[model samples]
Target: MSTNTVAGVRPAAEPTASQGAAAAFRGAVAAEWTKLFSVPSTWWTMLAGLVVMAASALQLAIYAANDNTNDDPLDDRGIVTVGSVVIDSVELTQYAVLALGLLAITAEFTSGTIRTTLQCTPARGRVLLAKAVVAGAVTFALGLLLGGVGALVARPTLGGWGSAPAAGTIGDIVAVATYLALVGVLALGLGAALRSAVLTITVLFAILMIVPLSLMEPDIAVLNRIADVFPGVAGGHFMAGDTEPYPGAVGLLLLAGWAGAALLLGRAALRRRDA
Candidate 1:
């Protein structure tokens, strides 16, 4: 046997700190961030939310301004613009956010890139988290911008129909933005769990839209009460400051429960499924 070991047969070196699994996750997040913005649909959805909100607010403002009288000029205008327009805008723009959330994951499934995503971030949970984080952040920022701009634009047009929002209006705006982000994250989780955009979207639409309409009956008072705790219902209560049916804090908790349950269920499915 040769006294010296062959150079080519030297012992394998230990993995470097840079090569650790945590580093891989950080890289995955960065790549995911880039991939999220690179998609054209993302920008389109965001723009749609902003435009719809602003346009609705502007229209309400103009209507309020034109209808203003000596007795009711600015204050009345403010109420119509903020109360009616903002509610309508929230309902409409949320659809765009839903689409964005659904596409965030379903597109990967359609394109067969989910496998590649899993390969890079094998934990599966981390992948889900990364998707939620990116989608949630974007939706929240857009919601805040849209809401703020809508409020600002409506301010000038409120001849007497509107009043300036109180000092705590910022808190209300923040709540709306937070709600939007939570809804987006919930949608993303649902998408991942279903892995089919059409099915997920349809289910979401029915839950958010149809159920509430259908349950508006005297005979269904109990059902309506239960449905009031649903995400959409709770969201409406939050935006309008309507605590007749449910207290504000209780409504918020109900919404939080919906979000948390959806997230947990989706995470479990993501972990168990084939990605």
Candidate 2:
């Protein structure tokens, strides 16, 4: 150790292992955020998702209003609440967020930039974690935006006949945001594991929509149970506060479990595979 005699001079100490790891994680997160926002697709996807949400919400609201005005209102259609409208819009337009998450990680692989990324950050797990964080955060914000816009667009029309319970509507919005964030994490995990944007998107869509739809029949108990646990169904249950099969919290937990499982698989694949 050299003792510096210069005024206000001191030798800098090396960062501890934990501190180094934290710094590396922070760097990775910053890099991922930069990479995600630097592209035009992110903005375009968000805009498209917003448009779809607004359109869906407006249409639903108008229909509800029109039905209420008629003498022979459809009793089969349950009360059209703000929460339902927002959640329904989100359900219809979640593909944009999923696409965002898939592209966040797979773009690197597709463009051969993942090799450079791995070279720069040798700890593959940290890179994946960072990507998950970035994708989750962006999708969460997008969810909030979409939910808020849908509510605003629907309020004028819905006020004529639909109900807008403050607590329920706010809960639904927050739940949608949480669901979208976790869904993004799931997509990130798949993207990391597969390293192909197209394949990951297709597989994610199937898992979220197609499989669940195929198993939605109530007559098949086993299939219904399996479908209820899927991410899309679980998210719907949580956001809508459904009590059937299980409580809303259980649905959130199931969705979270799915995301966690995907992340573990992604981490394992990332560590074992060559960049």
Candidate 3:
């Protein structure tokens, strides 16, 4: 009887060392992280975010020092420290974080590097997960650094009117960090799903900026509620150091929901579309 295998058929090729290297999730994550931090934009954007936060806080401190108000100590402190800067600085910083996050995924698409990335690790979900982890960690660290410095610098300038942030202030700092990180993840997901940086950034800006402003009208209570669920608004509530109609935990959960939904959508897009 003829052999079942074709005459030219050979034994299956052994997995190469490089392919074997990416066997674990941690290895894959490390590889992706190396590529991410190596990009120049990552450093530039991070530096810019830090600078903006510091400058805004400094400006507020100078102004407060000049005015030297004794009214409502916390308000004076917030003014001198937080400065005249609105939560918008934090919101703007989110845009930079978003850009870095989008580039994390879109860079692969733009350079056709994603094929190589996939070849090294065939699981698409893992690739997305790795990107999310790296982006989230970086953004979170930067957020904490920026927020703390901003608060610290402003405190003394405000004539020490503002009491030191309570232990709960740590929670607020953590919330800001979490918000920045989640926004980065959300942008990564959008970039992956859309595979277009401009489109992703535009959509994110609209969702985070325009939507909130438009919904703030008194007639738009329902829309306002919906907009409040976004990371920008939820983050605003946390950084504002005030209670809102919604519980702080609820705001966090809402932000989490946005991040989770975006990630799921990106994953679905990845599975459905060709690289």
Candidate 4:
């Protein structure tokens, strides 16, 4: 027998701490993904969003097509912007997107499954990050679907209205998808911290819709500035490629900042509080 060998075999090396942590995080993400897709409400909410977007697209397209005051549809200086029609449909359907994100985490808490999740993962931050990853991804896809469907449904009527440049239309669709992805992560963060579906949904709705609408007046410079920073308004500016208040890129950064802040808040709560 060789001195360096024992029974012609060697013991396996133990995994490093980093490798162990990585494995745990990956497992957590897989669990979160399974939980999200397995729910019936997830499909229903997404379907509702699709229906709303299609309906809104039809309505907006019809209205745009009926406008005969414009001397030239190609000039489109006074006519409705085709990009706006796509964005408007997305706006009408975004609630379902938010609901999908919120439910991912809140449902776990509501059903007492979060405790089980935490027990399995042990590291709360990993669990929350996993939820964020899964929610953000699914909602990003939802955004793309909604945006594409809306554009296709409206293009037949509004295709000539305004400039309807292919580049601009494509940009708007991408922006819509990006915005919805950030909004989904934001909702997931809020859900993790609040742990109540109803309350989180209500608060998120107010932040995205009610507050922005209430501050819509441009007369007040202060209010206008505040409104411009809200995720909903910022997302609108991004999708429309508006330069007012800030460039579309800046608007995207602002929305991303909001999502980052929410995730940080959720991380703190998850680490400090018991599941």
| Predicted model with the maximum TM-score | 2
- Candidate 3: tens digits of C-alpha lDDT, residues 1-275: 33645786766778887777556678878998899888898899888887777777666556656555656556443332242232434755677668888999988898999999999988899889988889889888987887787676666656654444456446556767778888888999989999999999999998888878878866577887877877778766656654775776777777778888889999999888989
Instruction: Decide which is better by lDDT, 2 or 4.
Output: 2
lDDT of 1 at 217: 54
lDDT of 1 by residue, 103-215 (tens): 88988999999998888788888787778878788888877887787777777666566666555456656667877887888788888889899998888887777887688
Return the lDDT, model 4, position 271: 90
Q: Per model, how many backbone clashes are there? A: 18, 0, 1, 0
Q: After superposition, how far is residue 271 of candidate 2 from its true place, in Å?
A: 1.8
C-alpha local distance difference test of each model: 0.76, 0.87, 0.76, 0.85
Q: After TM-score superposition, what is the CA distance of residue 25 in candidate 2 from its true location, in Å?
A: 0.6
- From the highest TM-score down, the ranking of the candidates is 2, 4, 1, 3
Q: Highest lDDT: which candidate?
A: 2
Worst 10 residues of 2 by lDDT: 70-79
TM-score, every prediction = 0.81, 0.92, 0.80, 0.89
Please provide, for model 4 over 83-133, each residue's C-alpha lDDT reduced to its tens digit, 9 standing for 90 to 100: 678898777788889998889888887888888888898888888899899
How well does candidate 2 match the true structure in TM-score terms?
0.92
Shift of residue 226 alpha carbon in model 4, Å: 1.4
RMSD to native for every prediction?
5.6, 2.2, 7.0, 2.8
